[model samples]
Target: MLDPISILNLIDDVMYFPILIIVMAIAGLYFTFKTRGVQIRLFGESLRILLEPPDKEGAVSSLQAMLVSTASRVGTGNIIGVSTAICLGGPGACFWMWLMCIIGASSAFIESTLAQIYKQKDHKGHAYGGPAYYIEHGLSKPKLAVLFCIFLILTYAVGFNMLCSFNLQSTFIDYSFYNPTTTPVIIGAILAILTGYCLLGGGKRIIKITSTVVPFMGISYVIIALIVIIFNIYYVPSMFELILKDAFDFTSIFGGLAGSCMVYGIKRGLFSNEAGVGSAPNASASANVSHPAKQGLVQTLSVYIDTLLLCTATALMCLSTGIPITPAVSGAPYVQNAIGSVFGPIGPIFITVAMVLFAFTTLIGNLYYVDNALIFLNGKTKPSEKFMRIFHVCCAFIVFIGATISMDAAWAMADITMGGMTLINLPVCMLLGKIAIDCLKDYEKQRKMGQEPVFKAESIGFEKGELDFWD
Candidate 1:
């Protein structure tokens, strides 16, 4: 019998490489052509629209939704995950991640737009939708929707946040001299309390918090990275050369582990941006926008920020530092040493602060997905306050336990759960891809007519009464 870790790796192997990559890549390429490269052509509009305020009395602003999902995307994965990829797959991994970010932006747009088009009001009377809603309402398959929701609850609600906590705790243990056992306990308790507080405040609070914190942390980290990169400007050319050379030269990347470079690159990119994995749509659905594509465009920008900017920063910092490749030199240590080499002892401290902020926001963002899932499970009825309280408490307990576990175990658990989610969601997204294409055409038509686009269910061949909210 396979051990638990081995079993998880097997699941990842089965799902991630051939099917997930192909399905997502095709969806992205199809939409990129479908919209004439919306991610590139609409770049300025995305930024301008991002700064616009939310609809009056809307549940979430487009920016807030983007930030909330980005909070989850730009976590320890950007830091530790990048290092792991480069160490295992060589510098070539960065190129694949960039490719995913570029192409995956289209996938992000399609999924998020469909989310908005098919959005329905929850029991609380606020807008909500996701792959589950689209699957149930569009394809008329409630059971499949339930299965997808279960995957989401397992991935984000339970296992994913545990992975974040584990990374944060590892940073604590690695950088500080506190009692290992006591430090994690104390940190876990504090994190649990904080997480419970945020979860109880509801989705509105989650969006607001993420909107504020995500930008601050992201900008600050990027600025620091830019400073370091500037200081080491001479190494930039060599870094690019290494990435380009090793990208196709598999023999140079993996001495005996041949063919694993592409595998690690794609896996890490999927884990980082989550473009076609059907997660961001949940957040996008909550936003109030005149057109579904507006939020779609906003959510698409998040992929660039996650992999292109933040993940790239980590990759360059690690590569430019000329750090030795070894098991011990990977993950958080790799980042710590890279930056520490530039800034001295304070470098590690800087990374620790960034990790805590990024990981904590990720924990909160992960819970927001679960909150939406609970709303889905309730089936037009709002979750009771008592039920939500119990759920929040359970989540806090999970966080505490996660913080106390070994990093390897937490990561394995996250990979297995996330792989299950990708397996379920990518196919569903493909099934619903055409709806998004039609919606984009409709949005563009209205734009050309010098009108702000508004979605009408009838325009999409749905009777007024068939859709829950978009009448």
Candidate 2:
């Protein structure tokens, strides 16, 4: 009889493999065309507006939203997930990863634009929205919205948290001086305390924390990776050649196994940037921007930063160091070994610091996503402080347990939920793509007219005041 993990793996193989891949590719291309390649055409505007201060009084700046979401995207997935893709799929997987990011940027723009279009103002005057809000309000399908929220909470908030916790614990324990048993427990306790403190303050606090941490941590890691890459500058051309060749080469690094390249590329790419999977929209909806399309454009840049910049940095480091790609030496350990080969004694220590920051920020960012889901389920009523406190405590406990558990089971559970969540999100984004397209058109028109763009639901055929905050 198949155990639970085996069952989940089988279901994932059947459900997520070609179906999700094809759908995501189609959705990305369709959104790109529908919006006239907004991700590329408006690239300068996205960066320009990203630097603009928070204009609206109630919501976080678009930059804050991007950073918070980036905090989640740039986690163990970039480090460990990239390594897994190379180990299973070969160096060519990096090319596919880049392809997914470029194509999927359009999907990010569409969903994020729709998220802002349909966003609601809580009683406290703070904004919150995501696929759930847009699905119900934009599509008038509350049941499907509820189902999406459930899957999102399960996949991101709980399942992915466990996976991150386990990764963080294992990396530290492997490198630390203490006994593995006691070290994990101590780490778990510290994680719980720190996470609990952040969670207690709610969304505003999370934005503040992530905005500060994301840039510092991201730049620091990239700097380290760049140093390694510069040292191996001569190998740069060969690395690029191998990646491109292996991507299309029929024989593969392991004879006739080239197909795994596409599979792992798409899988790890989705895990890394989270472009069409509907997660970033949750954070994007919280931004206060002159136009909904502004946040959308900002989010499109995030996919590039995550996969093209950070994940690529990790891949180049490993490939440049000539780390043997073997199953026995993969994931975080593979990254550690590569860094160790470059910098010697400081390698594991550097990775430990990087993983801790990456994983911790992911934990907080994920908690915000789940918090929005809980808010949706609880209706428009403001959750009492006590209820939120209980929720925070539960999150802390999950982090603690996650730090101590077996990662195989944790990741299996995450894959099941991630696949289910994507299945729900992809169809909904396609259904609602028109609204975002129209909003992008409106934004462009206003920009060309030398006016700052403002959105009205009525402009898109919605009844006046249909949106909570937008006119």
Residues 1-471, candidate 1: write the lDDT tens digits. Answer: 987766766666667666667776777787788789999999888897798777667568999889778877888899888888887777888898898789889888888988898898766777888988888988889998888888899888777888788778777655557687798888888888888877777456655665576668778877777777887889899999988988888675445432356667777887889887889999899898887888988988999989988998888877877778666766788888888888888888988888887887888778778877877889755699999889888988898988887755776677667777766666776787777877878888888999878888777677769878776
Residue 187 lDDT (model 1): 84
In model 1, which residue pairs have backbone atoms overlapping below 3 Å?
none
Q: What are the models' TM-scores?
A: 0.91, 0.92
lDDT of each: 0.80, 0.83
For model 1, the stretches where C-alpha displacement exceeds 4 angstroms are: 55-59, 122-125, 176-186, 197-214, 252-259
Q: What TM-score, to 2 decimals, does candidate 1 have? A: 0.91
lDDT of 2: 0.83
Q: Give model 2 RMSD, 1 decimal.
A: 2.8
Candidate 2 lDDT by residue in tens digits, 201-300 = 7456655665676678788889989988888889889888988988887655346332377667877888888887789999998888878999999999
